[model samples]
Every structure is written in C-alpha cells, then in structure tokens.
Target: MKLGLKIKTAREEKGLTQNDLVKISGVSRASLQLYEADKGNITLDNLEKIANALDYEVVHFLSSNVVPQSKKTCPPICPSIEKNMSPNMSLNNICEFIENDSPLPPTQSNNSVRIPVYDEVYASAGQGFINDEHITQHIELDKGFLRSYFGLTSFLDLSIITARGDSMLPAVPENCQIIVQKGTPREGQICVTRIDDELYVKRLQKRPKYKLISDNKSYDDIELEGENYEILGIVVGLFQKIP
Candidate 1:
C-alpha cells in the first residue's frame, strides 16, 4: 500500500478522527489531513510523534514491502570527461560542466547576481553621519545570474550582502547573506538603513513613531523620527554559507 493508505488504515484502526489526531499531535487540522492523505512530506520528528500517539514503532507505519517508482534515464556520461575530472570539483568546474552541456555562454544574460558587500554597522554608526553616497562598483546582472549568485528567485531583482555585525543575529546573523530588493520600505518590513552617515540593517517597525529592532537579544532597539534615518532598501531573504 501507499504511504497515505497506510496512514489512513492506521488512523482507522485506532478509532481516531483527523481532528483528534490534530489535537493530540499539536499539528494543524489541515496538516493532519495531509498526513493521513499522504499528500505532504512529514518530518522525522512529526513521524515519531505520530507513531507514539498511535502506539506503534515508527518503521511499522511505513510500507516496507512497497517499491518506489523508477526515475527516467538520462544520457550516458562522457568517458573522457569522467576519467579526467576529480571527485571534488570547484564551482568553476561545475560552471564548465554547464558550458560543455550547452552552446550558450554564461555571461550572455543580464541577471541579478549576489555580490558580497561589507557587513552592516550599528551602535557606533550614528544616524546623523550615515552616508548614502558610499561609492561601490555594482555590476548589472540577469535573472539566472542573480538566482545562481544568491540562491534566490531568478525572476526577482535580488542580491545578497553579508551582515557585518551581531545586531541582527539569531534572526539575521553576522556574516549571513541578506537578500535585498531595491524598493521603498513597506510598513513592518525588514530593511537596510543609513542614518547619520552609518549603515545598519534592521526590521522597520512603524508605530506612532518609527523603531528599528534587532533580532539578537544583545542589541537594543533604535527609535528614529523625521530626518534621522533613510531606508536604503527592503530585505526580502537571508541565508548562511556553510564552511
């Protein structure tokens, strides 16, 4: 039987309804339905919880006898290339693989590419001295280039920058690649800011007065009004590079 059918059988044997499983498992009602229907991926943690609730070993719930469907085949590898290439190849080698596979050049398209920039500065960087005129070389990019560079949506005008300080850590960590969109700040959006000649990244909390909050507990919140700050751009995503 399929995974979904197995789950349904198990639930029915236990005399439990989807709502009852939802309450017991602390999973949402929709998610419980998906689990029983086998329409969604269940984490190992959730699977364990479900097994415990149903009084079964985790493996017992799976269809061990069922065989998975076979995948479609691809072309055979080039023996010459395979023999010459190392098991551990660099990014350049991977790009060369793409180049060899297709007739198109890599740089033909203008897409947004993730470029590493300086880390954000907070605390010591005053609002009065923040400078927007900081000269930096920005390369024009295409969607594919941008997506490959930052590992983000290829169609969006997005680029990644590393966070320099711990002010936004836990949520936005230091040295994390923060995805930025060049646009006006919406209310309650996370953004990069320049104030008093210094640059910082914080979530923009607009109440009766504007406030900037750091995700890290060590950093204090900042309040600004009038000319104290300017929104550089809104932050849409973030990621960390594993060494």
Candidate 2:
C-alpha cells in the first residue's frame, strides 16, 4: 500500500478520527488529511509522530513485506536487523538498519546487495519509453564495490534498467544495463527523466534554458524550459555484453 493509504488504514484501525489524531500526535489536521490522502511529500519527523500516535513502529508503514526469519541461525550483522538470521529483511528494513550504520560482516558471500531490475522498462536513448512497475528480476552487486567505486551511501538508492537505442552512442551503447543512483541531478549529468509519462536517458544541459542533450547529434534535443519534468535518477555505471 502507499504511505498515505497505510496511514489512513492505521488510523481507521485505531478508531481515531482526524481530530483525535491531530490532538494526540500534534500534527495539524490539514497535514494529516494530506498524508492520509497520499498527496504531499511527508517528512520523517511527521511520519514518526503519526506512527507513535497510532501505537506502531515506523517500519510497519514503510514496507508491506515484513522480515522473515531464516531457517539457519547466523550471526547478527547488526542489532537493528537481528530479527532475521539471514538477510531476509524487506528493502525498507534493510535500508533503515544499514544506512550510516557499521558495515556488515565481511564474508565474501554475504557482502552483497540486491538491486531491482526493471526488465520491461527502458530509458530510451533516442526516444522515450513509457515508465512502468514491471520488475522482472534483481541484480546482486557487491556492497563494498558500490561504496568504493560509486560512493553510494545507501543500497536503496540504486536501480538497474536497460538503455535502448544508440542516441547516447559511444558513452551508453544500445542494449546495455544502466546502473542509476537517486540523487540531485546537476547540469551536464546524464540522467533518466520523465516527461508526459515517457522515460528518456539523456544528458542535461543549461544553454540559457534547460534541455536534454543526446550524444548522437542525429537525435533532436528535448527542451524543458516550460515543460514539467521529473529527474528519475543519475546514470552512475553501465554493464555491456562483450560480444
């Protein structure tokens, strides 16, 4: 469920009205309504207050899939993630427990993270691909390698998607796997962006006005001076088949 729906469900289950929650949690009624409706960007502080008021942990609303216990008993990586012997924690839980915490046990077999692969979603190099939620599989990457090579702070910030077409040509060839990270996009950074529900992989440039620049000049640049756009992520790495 979405964050707003989760909050609304929790509130209804607790039999607390909006006014009651506002009084108890000290969150404004308008803010609470917006949160329950899933409309605005909710802050961590607000979420915590509402969670505490609803008599639940923040994790309860963060992930639908709870951490499952491993059949084999293994040493705990950290105190926060001891509920499961193996790394069976949900994506949200893993991020919650691991971000800025001590590194996990240095066993080669265990020192890895799983990044979701959008098999059906392509960030087009020539044209735009319609964005979707169809995740076909996950790619496992070495945690230390990501941290050292890409300077990644959280595993949750990564995603793997396919790059289609030769518009990005020399730098990002067609049919290559792109490793993108969630961050503030800067000028001239190659990023995945969405406009009118279409996804595109292009380098951002500000030539007095913002635009999406294609490496292959044969393709036309997308002007974003007045068009609404969303920066999905910045391209950090790529994996191409050696054929």
Candidate 3:
C-alpha cells in the first residue's frame, strides 16, 4: 500500500479523522492530506511525529509504504518546497528529480542547478549597481567546478546576493559573490536585507538600536528596524570566479 493510504488506514482504524490526527500529531491539515493521499515527500522529522502520534514505529511506516505517485495529484506537485527554496526554484516542482535514478550533480544535482543572483551594488569597489524587478534569474556553473571548491555538491539551500558597492571592500569586492544561508540572520554577520522598498548587502549590528554597518568607512551606516526591513538570508560563503 502507498504511504498515504497506510496513514489513512491507520488513522481510520484508530477512529481518528484528519482533524484528530493533526491535533495529536501536530502536522498541518494540508500536509496530513498529502500524507493520506501519497502526494509528496515527508522529512524524517515529520514522519517521526506522525508515527508517534499514530502509535506506530518509523520502521513500520517505511517498510509497509511506498513513495508518492506521479501525475493525478492535485496541482500535480507538492508544495512542501515553497518555504525552503529561493524565488528561482519552485517548491512544488521537484518531483521529477526524486523519481530519477541518477545521483544529483555537484553544486546542484536536482534542485542545485540554479543559484539566484540578486541586485548589484556599484558604489562599492568602483562598479555600478544595477537593480532589477525580475532578479530571480539563476546562474548554472559546471558540476565539476562546484565540487572542487565545496565538499557538498548540492547548493540547494543557499542563495547568492550581489555586493554592489565598496562598503565591504578589502574583504568583499564590489559585485562580490555572497552566498546567503536561507534562515534567520544573526547580528554581527553579513546579511542581504530588504529595507522597505530597497535591497542592501550589509553587516547587521545591534548597537542599542538595529542598524547596518559598512566595513568601508567611506560609506555611512544606516539604522534599521525589524518591521521596516526583512532579512533575506545570512552570508554563509563568498565566491569569486577566476577572470
């Protein structure tokens, strides 16, 4: 039987509706529907929660069930990837990759093929900054090239933002490659931020008030607030191509 069918059967046998299982398992209504319908992939953590709530073991859940079915699914793909991906990637459109027998390529096997590039800051390092409304375009580098520098081949969870200005000079040049980690931004760390209507690559500092500081003293620092700005991602790694 399919995983979803098994989950649905287990739930019904225990006299639990989808509501009852969600309340007991803490899984979302949409996800529960997927689980019962065999729609998409479920992380190990979530599967564990459902198993515990349904009074079953992870072994039983996996050993007795099958993967999601292709086609005939509502909306055709699962929406689970939405929260974990950048604009260039579609959370619901990664099913073809899962079904493939081949291994993922270096830097991007399945979801790693595209790395998004945000705007450029020109004032830094004597380059011109360019902004685009449609900035979610991705860059595809050679698979072997990415493997040479990074141990992990997949850059699935990372995003690339541009350093347009020279504010982070000497360390990060203008038009520098700043790979942002997709999660909460930390203070005293380099972050790609959206300040109201504008985007910036700056270092976040909590000096009594929220503010972004520039490493290049020639440029001035700007004060910020949680409401006015959003942290796009954290600067996990920096890259530069050999010219």
Candidate 4:
C-alpha cells in the first residue's frame, strides 16, 4: 500500500478522526488531507510528526512496503537507513542510525552529494552586509532528492546561506538557513539579489516594474528601476531547527 494509505489506515485504526489527528499530530488540516489523498510530497519531518502522533514506528511508514507514490524511485530522506530498513527495526534503531553521522555505506556513498554551506550573510527582511564568501561546512544530501525535487542535473549550483532580519517575516525567518539555487529569478519567486553593495532575499516582481517585495507589510518594496543590481539566485528551500 502507498504511504498515505498506510497513514490513513493507521489513523482509522486508532479510532481518531482527521481533526483529532490534527490536534494530536500538530500537522495542519490541509496537509493531513493532502497526505490522505496522496496529493502532496510530504517532507520527512512532517512524516515523523505524524508517525509519533499515531504512536507508530517511523520505519514502518518509511519501509519499502509503504513507499510514497509521488516519487517511486526516489528513496526516503536517509538512503543509508532506507536502503537497509527491515520490518523489525525499532524507532530507537532509527534514532541511533541518525545520531551517528557516518558516511553512507560504501555502496551508497556514490549516490550521495555534498552541498556547501557558506558563512556569508544575506538579509531576508532587511539590508544584508556584503562579506567575502567563505564555506563553513558541507552537508550531504541524497542525489536523487536533489534531482527529483529541484530538477537539477548537478549539485554545484546549490549553496546554503544564513538569512537574518524580519523583513521577510514568517516566510523566511531570522537566523534561518536558505538553500539557494544559482540561476535567474522567475517572477514571483523568492530570490537572493544584490543591489550595489547590499544583498537581500526578497520576492521578485516584474509585471508593472522591476521590484523586490517583502512579505511583511511594514517593509517597503524596493523599486529596481535604475539600481545596479544582480539576481544572485532563487531561494529553493529552507532549513531551520524544528521547534
């Protein structure tokens, strides 16, 4: 059965309604409905939340038997674990596997890719100070997830940078790390832009005139009519510690 069906079956067996699941799982009602209907690409974090809410082992949800229908070939978050998962593995085993950040097994290491995390700062809601680019670390991510989710042939164009300020507000919160895919910005997409000496993370707008928009209304939209600016890249993903 599909992962969604498995979740739905487990929820039903628990004698809880969708609303109950929402309250217990802390997952939005809309997302729960989407997962049940198999219309969404549920993230690993959200999947873990749902599994915990139902008091079920997360491996049970991630097993090959319950593969998500959206991406059949794409392995779940950690290929190191998913590739070796067994029906008998407990949740504690999964945790232990994660705490030890060893390289993927020799056979699967080739399937992993490293994306750099830069120490440069960019303002999501305010003016960003320009600094020399320095790579702080490298994070390993599944090659398939990058290709399938971001539609990128290679991981060289991707970099992670820290976002600061509240101008972007709830969308890109202060201190959050943003994954930027180096490329041209599309209209209405959140992008990293450099104007003169300052850097910014804002939504790109090109309809009436070239502008950078902030989600927070208190921050004024930047008109780029005659500014010396360059579109660094678009914000493709965000990484933050789960509260």
Best-fitting candidate, measured by TM-score?
A: 4
lDDT (tens digit, per residue) of candidate 3 on 1-243: 556777887788679999999999888999989877778667556777787677554434443212333222313123322211111112122122122343323344432245544432222222212234423334443333345434444555555454445667766665445666566667787776665445566788987888878787887778886456666666665544222
Q: RMSD in angstroms, candidate 3?
A: 17.7
The digit string of per-residue lDDT tens for model 1 on 96-119 reads 111123322323333233232221
Worst 10 residues of 1 by lDDT: 88-97
TM-scores across all candidates? 0.41, 0.49, 0.41, 0.52
List ranges where model 3 is wrong by over 4 Å: 1-113, 118-156, 241-243
Per-residue lDDT of model 4, residues 1-243, tens digit only: 566888898898789999999999899999999999989988768877887787664545543222222222222232121111111000011111121244323232555555554543332333332223444334556565556655667566777665666778788876555778877888899998877646677999998999999898788889999997778788887654443
Worst 10 residues of 4 by lDDT: 83-92
lDDT of 2 by residue, 10-69 (tens): 788779899999999988899999988878767656877887787654544543332312
Model 4, position 28, has a per-residue lDDT of: 96
Model 1, position 118, has a per-residue lDDT of 23
Report residue 55 deviation for candidate 3 (angstroms): 60
The C-alpha stretches of model 1 lying farther than 4 A from their native spots are 1-159
lDDT scores of the candidates, listed in order: 0.49, 0.61, 0.53, 0.62
Give the Å shift of residue 85 in candidate 1. Answer: 47
